[model samples]
Target chain A: MAISEPIVLPHATDEVRLARTWAQPRGFWGWFMNVHHTAIGVRFMVTSFIFFLLGGVLAAMIRLQLSRPENHAIGPDLYNQIFTIHGSTMIFLFAVPMMFQGFGVYVVPLICGTRNIAFPRLNAFSYYIYVVGGLLLWVGLFLKTGADAGWFAYTPLSGPQFTPGKRSDFWAQMITFTEVSALGVAICLATTILRQRAPGMTLNRMPIILWEKLVLSFMVIFAMPAVMVVSSMLLMDRTINTQFFNPANGGDVLLYQHLFWFFGHPEVYIIFLPGAAIVSTLVPVFARRHIFGHLAIVTSVVATGFLGFGVWVHHMFATGIPQMSASFFTAATLMIVLPTAVQFYCWIATIWNGRLQMKLPMLWVFGFFFVFLIGGLSGVMLASVPVDWQVHDTFFVVAHFHYVLIGGALFPMFAGLYYWVPKITGRMMNDLLGKVHFWLFFIGFNMTFFTMHFLGLRGMPRRVYTYPPEMHWGGLNMLASVGALFMAAGLIVFIVNFFQSKARGTLAGPNPWAAGSLEWATSSPPPDYNFTELFTVNGREPLWDNAPNQPIVSGVRDDIPEVLITNSLDSEPQHKDEMPGASIWPFLTSITVSIAFIWSIFSPWGIAYGAIPVVITLIGWLWPRGHSPAPRQPALEGRWSK
Target chain B: MAELEHTVRKGEAPALIWWCMFGGPFAWACDLGFSYVLEQHTCSTGHHYVLHVITVVCAIIALTGLAAGMAAYKRVPEEANDHGVRPMDRTHFQILFGMVFSIAFTIVIIAEAVPRWILHPCQ
Candidate 1:
């Protein structure tokens, strides 16, 4: 039955009329001002892609400089600032947001049988805050006050006395803005997963993606707070002369290290988990079966979140922390590999059992396995208290992280983008172009980062603005620079491919991937309310398992907007739960939050002044003065109505 | 709004409100219980016996208030189904389990703290 059909109801209620009246916006400007998750998600992807190109350009510059010892391709000051922003932008502003939150916000609720993200306004707020925060750092670079102390933005070096400008503040404030945005989305995403499973989709029945997000959300909750606390302290020290990291004021620099790494190490897992989620989603589809050891996989993800916090001290092996504590962290770090191994083994077993399609996404998965393995192994070596003290600040550490982050995160993000582009844009990205982009990127990435391990092994220290000649590292450095160009070329291809596909690409059907997730059950580029009918699940793959017998209750009028409440254990009708209608309050509230943060960065009084607008906006959001939502229609017809 | 007309019984509102009024003390007791345990491990100089006693009393009052709040919900048991137990049975178990765990954890904290408190008197 088409939703457009007009039905004469036996009795029409005010609720039905109200629901119909609240139908999603239709005009061009409505889309321009859209708060829908789909549009917001596209914004996140497009923005992150732009940053990716920017970060790639930075990567090429670093490679060119490092290609030869004593190379003056770019001066040390410029080189340091370039790499700092590149790493910070890629990790903080680009990869994690684009891969996890962007993908999670747009897809999780749709997959889990909810109308929207738990907090729609907060989601929108996060998007805008990210844009403004990202621009702040870029603007600094444009203004030639680029931060040069490295992405970590370590204390004393990054302190006001040394940095002498708002350079470190740019990095610190960006961290504050991005982490706050991430923490908000994490809470929103986590709460949605816990409370809003589709009926019949018990904890056991949840897709691994939801479980992965749940774990990652908790990680963000614990990990981001540490950064927020530390960065705020750093900001305070800079602006207000707080003694948090000031030795003259009896402060310890080690405190900053403790707090930062407390966030930093777990952040690696935070990024990796979402990639794991995407792989979990795609791997099972290609395998043509339920994921192997679903319960065990969820357990591993949860354990990894807990263990990620314990291993932060490994990043500080040379900081001269107590020997026992260092050993304990090393042991903890090594222990975390068990859970990661558990997930890896499960993926392998899943593929081994089922017919594997060597598609583009799958190819990236294979690449992740190879690249991430080497990275993980190197990381495990670093986790050893003894070995790490030797290579603590060398290029080896750089290689190890890049392998994991790039192999673990970037490869999977590309695969996921390609895998979901059809569903997101309602069009297929050109597979030939995608494959070409992948190979060039894959080859270029390896060429650039792989040789850094040897460079480090030969005692080439990292963060040196320039290296002296006769270091015997000129050849490898030059080779790295040449390799960076390939990466640049690949990024260019990806950019062209992305825009080209957006303008003209094959129209994708709802389930282009022939996968069984709920997001695929709806139209590609899903409707505002997401599902047409609220679906009840009988098994893991509802569309596949139930097929013609898919359980759907009918009788709801399409005119009334209503949310279905399913039985938590089994997807069954409970009641209609209507959410508050959209208001301009969230946007207004976020503006206040941003004002407070930006002001606080500049002046202490900014916090005092900013809190007023924040309180006002928050009150407006919580005060229920909106029109009563549309009435509940009969369950069956309503399921498919949205 | 009309459909949301279901309200508490005529005499129930005041009692429910009074029960809710005890929430502060209940919260205080839980806080003391957690802190008392931690203090027992960390503090070597002084024992906080009065604090522990006060915390336990508050926790008991809190538990009572919680029970009263639950009573206000006033659910009834219905017939059993093929699922093997009545829904009421599950509800009862949930309520019982929650109360038991809450009280038990509080008592466990007190139990450990009291022993340490006796052994190490206030300086």
Candidate 2:
């Protein structure tokens, strides 16, 4: 195949025009109306981090109350709300948003060498929806109407019979809000990766992060529906006198468990796979080598996504599911571990084979390996029916998940933030403070979660407001509480480091780490138009392999926000796509949707009345204006086409 | 015109490649759903052999996927030294991924089947 000569643009003039075309709106209105992926991505990260802090605070409260047996600091009622809200906030509000939506929206386009995400307005809409959902949950908590039926909200206990009121309703509706937002973002990202890559970035040449995001997107698409369905059924049963989980009326309680865990188990992978992606991405850069076993890693990620769906029943072994069925699920659960082990093996091999750089970010990756490995081992134990039966509804299960979630999600998240913050803020974070923060967090995390295994073995049950003083669980509980304080101090250090770095840290150039991926090819804190000129890569590590002579895409209109559409598989240029400018419709539409969702908790007819405004706002959003007509498709024989 | 022509010349991937990629997972999903639904029937009817039959059928489907992957892999020459920008490189990656999926799913299917022989459905 013959390569066409690259298109040369008037760099100075085009940069100004591109900036003008893609610049977000200014001032207060601009904040809501901005549709750029970067702004929305940053919002997702910051908002989720706030939720993480809130969840952490709740965690501290729980620890304090539990530090001594028969403590009366928090009563049973409040304790139930605290623990449930803590679990919900971390998983629903923090983990998926920070790991998947935040990172994917922020970085995927830049790496793909495109100007913006595929559906920028929809991306903005998802963020607003998420904010409204977070607000609803917290507001419910303050008003003393918070969900207390566990995060999973298993029925009969959560049903209208045992626990009546709007408590469980709030939890179910929050699930709807976050999952809708997640599903919307998943569509945007999958399309962006499939259709918006710069020409020459075929599927084979994509970075491992993109592959992981793509897999993550599909997992969200497939796995979220089950949760949404089950949650909706719970809401209906509570509000509309529906008997979806009312066994007296022919609805089985185990059905709810089956549906929730169906989504619930994949929900774990949905959270962790992005963390693994962060590790996969950072390992190659820190090791100063091309990633070892790229194909193997990609296969493992895809396999993990598939196997994730099969292992959900492992969470249901003690529910008295058929022995044969339980055995199948147990087998499936153990099988899922192989892919993760393969990933860990590949990362170790990469670090061992290459010149390893023990940077701040890499330090967190090491933390992940240690913490998440323990979590994974415990998880394998829980996979067996006999072990799960022994420790069911105990602190051991709680400890296993905390190690997995915190280690698998939080550690890699810190690594990713540290690795990319320079690119995001155009300044470097303080290494000395970062080291202090890491040590405090690592020691605190292990101290807090590790003791729970013993507590479980010694017969401490989970979700209990208080234990008898004679149980002798006081000393270890106090240690865990102290560890919580240490973790809090570590977070405060990080918060200080983040703001300080933003204000006065060392200026970092674009390629601070001389990373191989395309995101490093542009300036730090990239311009409004991410790349002044689009690039077509010749290899996976585009900057490393084809730097200085990478082929530039041309014919994309500079006066308007136009992106190139490429073939899904081979990424050959096909046409130009004009993007919508900043608009307030997505924001307004989200408000309308939020009203509908919130109002429905009070009356089922809220959806009917809500649909009218939602339709009106949606019409306003999609109504086309003559000023920004779609770009004319270029000839197939043009420079970009060839 | 040249790019469109090239795309046309390259053509769609063989049906086998798609099957190789998704077939094993699809089979496993079917096996899981079927055996789960059949568990109650087996418990009531005392026909535990039906679960084993489902597993065997699913395993055979997974093996078919594995075979398809192997055939595809043999057809596409190794591009070990080539930059992965070419169509052949993409095909090679997909085939390898499909092969791995097939192999993994087969093992999972067999693993799921083992308990059927040992544990009574009612137990």
TM-score of chain A in every predicted structure: 0.92, 0.98
Runs in model 2 lying further than 4 Å from the true structure? A1-4, A7-13, A632-642, B1-11, B77-83
True contacts kept of each: 0.00, 0.84
Residue B85, candidate 1: C-alpha displacement in angstroms: 16
**lDDT (Cα, tens digit) per residue for candidate 1, span A338-419:** 7789899999999999988888888888888888999999998887777788887898999999999988888889889888
Kindly report which residue pairs in candidate 2 clash with one another: A636-B1, A637-B1
Please report how far candidate 1 places residue A6 from its true position, in Å.
Answer: 22
CAPRI verdict (incorrect, acceptable, medium, high) for model 1 = incorrect
Estimate TM-scores for all models: 0.80, 0.97
- lDDT, residue A247, candidate 2: 78
Q: How big is the positional error of residue B15 in model 1, measured in Å on the Cα after superposition?
A: 29
Q: All candidates' lDDT scores?
A: 0.71, 0.89
The whole-model C-alpha lDDT of candidate 2 against the native structure comes to: 0.89
Q: In order of the candidates, what TM-score does chain B achieve?
A: 0.41, 0.84
**Candidate 2, position A412, lDDT:** 98
DockQ of each: 0.04, 0.64
